[model samples]
Structure formats: structure tokens, C-alpha cells
Target: MIISVDHGNKSIKTPHLLFTSGLVESENQPGIKTDCIFWDGKYYSLTEKRISYLRDKTEDDRFFVLTLFAIAKELEYAGIKEPDDTVDVTLLIGLPPAHYGQLHARFEQYFLRKREVVDFEYNGRYYSIRIGKVVSYTQALAAAVTRFGELKKHASSYIIDIGGYTVDVLKLRYGKPDLAVVESFEQGVITLYNSIFSQCNSQYALHLEDCDIDEVIKGEPTILPGEVQILIRKMASQFLTEFCNFLGERSIDLKVSKCVFAGGGSLLLRQIIERSDKVGFPIFIEDIHANAVGYDLLYKSEVAAHGGQ
Candidate 1:
């Protein structure tokens, strides 16, 4: 079995592909809220009722710990088992690129040291085993796979992934990522939300909890002020412009084929790209779970290449 785990700022998404004998079965574990409680190097998830209690407590760092615990519990619930009887299981997790170099060792230690387990029944067999070992890779790996697959039909392409907290831009030359042309920006949908809330306090007083910005943007202007909408559009435009300029300086031809967009923030930012005339080629948006799905596919391919049982 190959599992691709994406731990996002807002939620954790895990998608798995089980390769048994000559067959492949795929399943997605629902996203879990990013809330947990940390105790003695172990984390536990808080129940919905516990969240309500924490809202009223306001204790120092209590919310942070509880949030971590909540996430850990959810991972346990997602069929991760303890290694009661030693079995070979390889797990690969995706991490933010920036953290790859800095937190690699620490992350490995945490996963290996942590005794958490995921419990589930498979093919009439019950198993309880700790993740044998957890491996971590940059989100770029997943992003690269997604871009390559989406642009494989084209000769060359550029990928722009506007995620929750960052925007990753890369150029693919013949289905392979040209790292020299890849760039990332901290400004994303969250930045837009903060900007809107900062500018129009009364008109756009809603918080992330009260509204789903992605859903609201899909329909007509219902909650956000027109002024805020304008700002968001401008921000999106600027991001794309910067990305294009970076590509141009690197001598990457935007006219090669098309530009592909993915990530949670892409839905809202697609309009800005579609309306822009300064861009040279057409823009396309991949599915919201593109990264997760791509990673799952990549993991499966890797196992097959190794001739795993």
C-alpha cells in the first residue's frame, strides 16, 4: 500500500492506493481539522465538544497543543496501525519545500519516535501496527507530478499553484520540472482575506470560520464588498504578473503551450488569470486534490517499478 499524506495549514488530507497482488485499489480518507493536544511527545485529537470548551478557556498555548493532538488522533483513525507484528510498510509524506532542508531530521525522528497507530480492517484481516517509518518529501514532488500529468499532452508548460499560504510557480520542459525557473511567494488567498478584512472592516466583517471564501466567490457577490473583490482581483493579477516576469527573465517561453493552476486557492484566482490579456497563453485549472492524487499515483508507480509484493 502506498499512502500520500498532505498536511495543510487548515486540514490534513490522506489518499491511499493499495497494491495487492496484481490489483490496485484507491481510497481517500476525509480531511481532518488541524487541531490537536500535545502531551509528553504524544498528540491526541480533541472532540468537537472539546473545541467548544477551549473557545471559552483561552489558556496560553492550550489551543495550539489541542489542535496538534486533534490532528494526530485523526491520523490514527485513518487506518494507521501499530507494528504489533513487524511488517514492512513504507509511508511517504509531503512537506512544505522550505521545511525540507531545515526540518528533515527532526521530522524523521518525530515520525519514528511517535507510537501512534491507525486501525482499520482490510480483506477480512484485522491489523494494528505503528507506521514502520514515515518518510517526508517536498510538496514540490507532488506538484511536479501533477504538472507533468496535466501538461504531458503539451510540448511545454508552466504551472502556477496558489495554495493556502503560498504560491508556487514552475516551468516544465518536456514534462520535467525546470527547478531553475521555479519560484514561490508567501502571498496567497489568506493574504487576500487579511487585506480585505483590514480595508473594509464593516462591509467584510466575516471571519474564516463564518464563511467559506472559495464557495462564496463561486456565486454572485453576496457577502464581500465590491471594493474587496476588486482588491482580490488586483492581488491575483500582480501574483501572475510577477510569475510571468520571472519566467521571462529565465528565457522560458510562455507561448510554448499553456499555464496550469492547482491548489485550494486556484478556484478563486482562476478568474483573474482568465481575464488577464498580458499573459501569453491559455490557463487551465486542475482538480482541488490534484497534489494529493498526483502523489498517490507517483507512489504507486514507484512501488510497481520496485516490483513490490
Candidate 2:
């Protein structure tokens, strides 16, 4: 089966599941009760190793390793077992537009022909898979295709994909992507999440967990103090304000006839941005996994473009 993964700084998302992108490589094996992948005498699972840029992220080998992990989980999600402990499959993934040019070839070449063999345990089950053809795309543009399908191709538009650790903007004029005006920045949900994390930490001296952060972002009921609740609302307001300020100045929104805000951040930003009088409401921002969906939807076209059936 073909698999697509959007490896964001905060999460690794497959079609059916969202795995925390907080992987840590540990020397000791995890307890039997723990859910983890044991490979090469080390255990790998969600930890606090959140990273956005290449400088701070793991090396290329670790990327390949994580890709293997994703593949294993992908197969499990499909309810398939690896005969001979090796299953061949095609893979599609994306990179930030800013990093696309520099990193695309490297990632493409990483798993070109090798029948990658991986043995790992997920949910206490042992599984293995042989990695096969891997293709890559610019995450933002891939998303733009789905968010703005061919039916609306000719419309001038601005796409702002607010990811976990990066904000990728693409300006489209007359149906063609305007790379010259495209921009990506470090500002993302993690920025706001981290700020809120620190604010609660300093104000209450309480180290809240990721679940708590998730609740705060999801607007779920929480036991946090009323003052902190006010602070949470304030932080959300500031995030959207800064987001609008950045999008207006950074993206070519003034020149476009349409605007779109995609990615997980869209969910949180939508409510606040809509209530604001300054920013224009977007027409499309539905699926949080639009990139993966787009990749799957456009797979045949892409393969055809590459001279395949």
C-alpha cells in the first residue's frame, strides 16, 4: 500500500492517526506495559524532543529511521502483516517550501532503491516492513492543490499553512504559484503553545503536560485558575493578532482575490480571526490533513507526470 506522512514538528500525521512528533531515542528498553518501538537495543517513542529547523533537528539518518517507524505504523493501520518480514510499498511525504529546494533531492535519494528492512513493536505487536519508492513534494503547494482544486485554479489566491513549527505562505496569481513571493517563517502554533506553557509555569509554577496544552488549545473545559484562563484567552488573541500582522505584511494578500488558511492552526485561528474586523474571512480551511489528502488525491496525476501509469 502507498503511504503518506506529514512529519510536522509537533506531530507526525498519517491518514488515520496523529502520532506525537516528540520522539526520543533511549538506550534502555521500555517496560512491557509501555507502547514503544524497540529496535537496535534502543527504544523510540514520543518524548519532548520537539524541533522545527534543520539546525536543531535530528540528522538525516534519524529521519530515515523515523520514516521507517511511520511506515511500520502505516502498515499496522492497514491491518497487514509483513510476509518474510519485508513488505514493499511506495511513500509520499512533504517538506516546507523554503526547505524543499535544498532538501528534496536528499530525501528522494535517501530511499530510492533500497529495500529497507525495519523491525519494531507498536502497541506491543512486532512488525516489519521493506520500504520502497519514496516521493517528495513541497508541503504547502501540495496542500494548495487540495484546498484550491483545479475548479478554482484560475483565481488569484493567498495560502497560509500554519503548521506546528513553521508558517508557510504561498501567493498565487492567475492560477500559477508565485514562488518569488512565497515565504516561510519560524512562527507557528508551537510558538503560542510554548508561550502559554511558560506563562502557566511561571505564574503558577505548574508544569502542565501536553494533554493539558491540548485541552487549552482545543478550548475544552479545564481546572486552570480564572486568571490563567484570562491569560489563555489573551495569549490566543495575541497569536491571531501577530498571525494577521505577519500574513498581511509577509504574504501578497493585498494583490490576491482569495485567501486560505490551512493546517491544524487554522482550527484555532479561524474563530479568533473571524471575530476580528481587520482580517478577511477565508473561503476554505477545512481538512487539517489536506496535504496528505491532496497527495493521495494527486498521486495518479503525479505518477503519470513522472511517465508512469
Best prediction by lDDT: 2
Error of 2 at 112 (Å): 5.2
lDDT of 2 at 67: 65
Error of 2 at 142 (Å): 1.3
lDDT of 2: 0.70
Candidate 2 local lDDT, 33-93, one digit each (tens): 5446776677776655554445233355555556666777767678775445556678888
For residue 81, give model 2's deviation from the true position in Å. Answer: 2.4
For model 1, how does the per-residue alpha-carbon lDDT over 95-134 read when each residue is reduced to its tens digit? 5555456665665555443656544333223344355665
Q: TM-score for each prediction? A: 0.64, 0.86
